[model samples]
Target: MASRKRPALARLTNALATPSQLQVSQALGLSGSLLSSLHYLGGSLIQVAGAILNIPAPTIATSAIIFHRFHLVAGFLEQSIRDTVAACLYIASKSCEFPLRPSVILAAVDTACQDPLAVGGKRIPKRKYTRANTETLDHWELRILTTLAFNLHVVTPYTLCMEYLVSANVDRDRQKTVAQRAWNYLNDTLKTKICILHQPNVIAVTAIWLAAREAELELLDGEKWWEAFDVDTEDMGHLVLLLREGRDIAIRERDRIESGRKPTLTVEDVKARILEEASLSSRQ
Candidate 1:
C-alpha cells in the first residue's frame, strides 16, 4: 500500500513551482506575488462553490487544480476574460460531482470576484454575468473542454499517497506532519504546470521523496527508496531531478529580486510606476 509514501507525494504536489507557470507570468507580465494571489482567488472561489453546493473539500480542491491547469493552457488573460472564472467553476463543479448548472456557477463566480478584485492594487470590479456574459462563459467552457479533449479525470498524488501511508501504518503524529506538508506542496504545484508534465503516480512518488528530504525524515533504510513504493527507480529519480531544478531556479530568482540588483521591480513597485505613468498621462 506504500502507506509510508503519502507525505512526500502530497508535498511534491504543493511545493514546487513549474516552468509553465513561470512562462505564463512572463507572458502576462505578472510578478510572482500577483500570480500567487490569482491562484488564491481561484482556490477561494472553488471553496465558495463547495460551500454553496455541499461538495466535499477534497473533491473541490482536486477539481480546482485541474481547472487551474486548464486556465494556464487557455492563456491566463486579464479580467476581460470573465469566462475564466465561470468556465473553471463549471468544470470543477462537474468533476467534483457537485454538478452545478452553468448559470449557478456563473453567478457564484461573479459574486466571489466582487468586493476585492484587486490586481496590482487596482480594484478590478467584477462585471455582471448578463446574457452576453453567460454566452461567453458557455463558449469558453466549450473551448476548455475541447482543449482538454473532454478529459475530466484528474488523478493527483494525494489519493495514492494516502493509501500507501495508511497501509504502511506509520505513527499518527508523524503521518499528520508529513501529510500536511505534502498537502501544501500539492496546492502549490497547481499554480505551476507540473501536473500536465508527468503521470500523477510518478509525480506522487517524486513528491514523497522531496517531502522526506525537506523534513529530514529517513523513511527508507537504504539508497533504494523507489523499491519501498514499487516504483521505477529511474523514472522517480528523473522526476526528482526535475523538481530540484525547478526549486533552484525559483530560489535564484527570489534571491535576485530581494537583493534589489535586478532591473525589474516587485509587484508593488510596478503598481506605483504604473500609477505615476497614468497620472502623467492625465496631466498631459
Candidate 2:
C-alpha cells in the first residue's frame, strides 16, 4: 500500500507523468485541471482499469493500458472521478455478462462512438462513425500509454482483492462475477488513494463484505449473490472490520454529497463516525 503520498514512491509518480518522451498533454491538449477533474469526476477510468484485467485472453491490454496512461496525463476532481468509476464498472459488467469478448467491447464502443468500426485500421465494420472518431480513439490510446510509461501490471482493486483472497486461501475463483461485483465497490473508494497508501488489504476486504451485504449475497437475504462461494474466516474478519468502518465513510460521503458539503474523511473523522454507527447499531 505504498501510496503516492509516500516520498519513496515519488519516482513512480514522476514516471507516471512522463507518458513517453512525447508528453501526452502536448499531443492530446490535456490540461492538469482537466486531467485531475476527470479522475475526480470519473470513476469510469478505475472501472475501466478493473474491466481491463478481466478482458479475457487473446485480447490485447492496449485499451486498458492506454486508459491508465491517460490518468497520469489527466487527473479529475472528486465528483466527476466517482461518476467515471461508475461508468467503468458498468462497462466491465457489460463486457463480462456477455462472453468476455474484445469484439463485444469494440461493438459497444462503436455504438457509443457513432463511428464506423475499423478492421485492421481500414475496413469500416460499422457505418455509423467517421474516420475522425476512430482516429481519435486510436490516437488517444497512444498518448495514454505514454503517461503510464508502458507499465501495464499495476495493482487494481479487482486484482488486489483477488490476490488477497488467494493468499488467504479464500476460494471463490470459479465464481468470478460474484467476486468482481464485490471488488468493484471497494475499488470505487480507492479514488481517494487513502487506502492505497495504507491498510489497503483491510479496505479491500471490507468492501467485499459490504458489497455482499448491500447486494444481499450473504447472511439473511443478504447472502444471495455470493452463497455459491466460500470466504475464509480470516478474510471475512478483516473484511468485516474494514466494512464496518467503511459504512461510516460511505454514509458521511453520501450525506455530504447530498447536502452540498465537501467530502473529507480524516482519520479521526472516520473513527468518530464508526463509533457513532456502533452506538446506533447497538441500540437497534
Candidate 3:
C-alpha cells in the first residue's frame, strides 16, 4: 500500500487501537505534529466548555471523554471530531438534570464556529450519533490514527516536577521553591523544541532541573538541594548536565540551518507530494 505522509496520525491510531497512545500521551507529551493536532481537539473542547459556561470539572471531563471517543472513532471533521465534540456536548446537556437536544448541540457548535448551517443546514443529513452510528464511526475513526502513530505523547515537564515534589518529603518553603523553579523551566520549554515531544519522565524532570541549575536558581534556601528529593544524588546531578547538552545541540542545529548545511524540504518535496496525490486520483 502507498504510505500516507502523516506518520504521526498513523502512529496515533495504532497506539489508540492498542491503548498505547494514552501511555505515550501521558509519558512523552506528544510530538510537535501531534500537538498540532491537539489544537483542534483542545479548541473544540474549550468551545463546548465555554458554551456551557463554567461547567463542573467532572462534567467537563465526561464531555471531553465523549468528544475524544468520537474523534477517535470518526477522525476530526464533519461527522468527525467537530461533530463528536458537538454531540458530546449535546449528550452531556441531556444527561445532565437539565435536558438538552441534538438541536441544542448543533446550535452551539454552529454559533461558536460561525458556521451557521451545521445545525440547520438543509443538505446535511441528520443521523443519530449512537450505537446505530457506531459502525460508520469505526470506519472513519482510524483515518488519522495510523498517520499519528510515530508521534505518541508522554509525560510533561509540569508532571515531572510534581512527581519530584511528591517524593521530596519537603516542607512548605521547599515546595514553593520547587514550583517556582519548575515554572521557570516550563516557561523556557515553550520557546524551544524541547516542548515538542515530551521525553521520558526522567528526561522531563532533568530538563527542568537542568534549566534551574543554569539559571542558578537556588532551591530550598540553597542548602537543601541535595536533601530535597530522595533521588539518587548522582542521577540528579545528571539533570544539570542535560541542560548543557540540550543547549549545545540546539546551537549546533541552529548553526547548521543558518548556514544552509541542514537540508531543506524544498520545491521538489512539494512537487513529489503533488504527483503522489495525482497518482492516487488516477488509480481511483
Candidate 4:
C-alpha cells in the first residue's frame, strides 16, 4: 500500500486529471495553452492585490499560497472565481500584516479579473460587487479559512533570491531592478504547477535566472550561477522552462485579446458553461 502521503501527492501531481479539472477542461474546451492562460490570470489577481493594498512581496506570496490551496481543496465547486481570489487576498492581507477592507479587496478583484479587450467598455461582472457584498465576502473569507484549516504558514523565496543576488556581486542599484523582476517571477510561478513540484529555493534561483536573462543582466559568467546554491542545475533549468511557458501563455493571452479574435470569458462564465455541459451530458 502507498504511504499516507503518497495518495495526497498523487492527487496533487495529477491535479488537472481530477474531476474538477475535467469539468473545467470540458466546459472551457480548454486547449493546453488556454489552461496555462488561466493560471496566468490567477497570478494577475495577486499582482493587483499587491498593487492596490501596497503589500510586501511576502504578502503577495501568501496570497498565492491561499489561492493555490483553495483550488487544491475546493476546486471549482466552492465559490465564484473572483470571490475566491478576493477571499484569498483578504486572508493573505491579514496573515501578511497588510490588512485591507473587504471593499478594497473587491475593487482589486474587479480590476484583476477585467478583460483587457473590454478596456473601452464597461466591464461585465457576473454580478456587481458593492459595499453591500461585504457580508458575502465575509462568508467567503470564512470558507477559505475553513478549507485551509487556518494553516497559513508560507515560506516564500523572496529572501533567498535576495541572498543569491548579493552573493553574485550584483551592484546595489541593478540588484534592486533584478530583485524586483525576480520577485515578479516568483509571484508568476504561483500560477503554475511548479510551486507544488519544486522547492522554494530552487524556484527562487530560477526566478533570478529568468529575470537576469530577460533584463540581459549577466550575473554570472557561464553556468557559475548555480555554484552557490545547493540545487541541481538541470532541475532549476526545468523550473525556468515552466516559468517561461507561463510567461509565454500570458503574452499570447494578451495578444489574442488585443486582436479581438474571441470574447473574453470570466471564471463565472467558464463555470456556468461547465455546469451547463455537465447537465446536458447527463441527459445523453
Best by lDDT: 4
Off by over 4 Å in 3: 1-42, 45-52, 93-101, 115-284
RMSD of model 1 against the true structure: 9.5
Best to worst by lDDT, what's the order?
Answer: 4, 1, 3, 2
Superposed model 1: Cα runs more than 4 Å off: 1-58, 61-65, 68-82, 101-104, 107-129, 230-284
- Model number with the top TM-score: 4
- Per-model clash counts, in order, read 15, 41, 32, 0
Please give, for residues 157-253, the per-residue lDDT of candidate 3 as tens digits. 4555666655545566656665676655553332222222222243345544554565555545555454333334465455444344444434553
Q: 204-249 in candidate 1: lDDT tens per residue?
A: 6666666666777766456766566656777666655545544444
lDDT against the true structure, each candidate: 0.55, 0.38, 0.40, 0.66
Candidate 2 segments exceeding 4 Å error: 1-37, 45-69, 73-127, 159-184, 190-284
Worst 10 residues of 2 by lDDT: 115-124
- Model 4's alpha-carbon lDDT is 0.66
Q: Sort the predicted structures by TM-score, highest score first.
A: 4, 1, 2, 3
Candidate 1 shows a clash count of 15
At residue 41, give the lDDT of candidate 1: 48
| Candidate 4 lDDT, 1-284, residue by residue in tens | 01112342332221122345334444533345544545555656666656655667778776776676566556554357777778888888888777887777787677666652221233323445576699878898898888766766566777778888898898888888989998878877877756645656678888888788887888767566665665678878788788889767666656766798654345655566546555665676
TM-score of every candidate relative to the true structure: 0.57, 0.37, 0.33, 0.74
RMSD vs true structure, all candidates: 9.5, 14.9, 13.4, 6.3
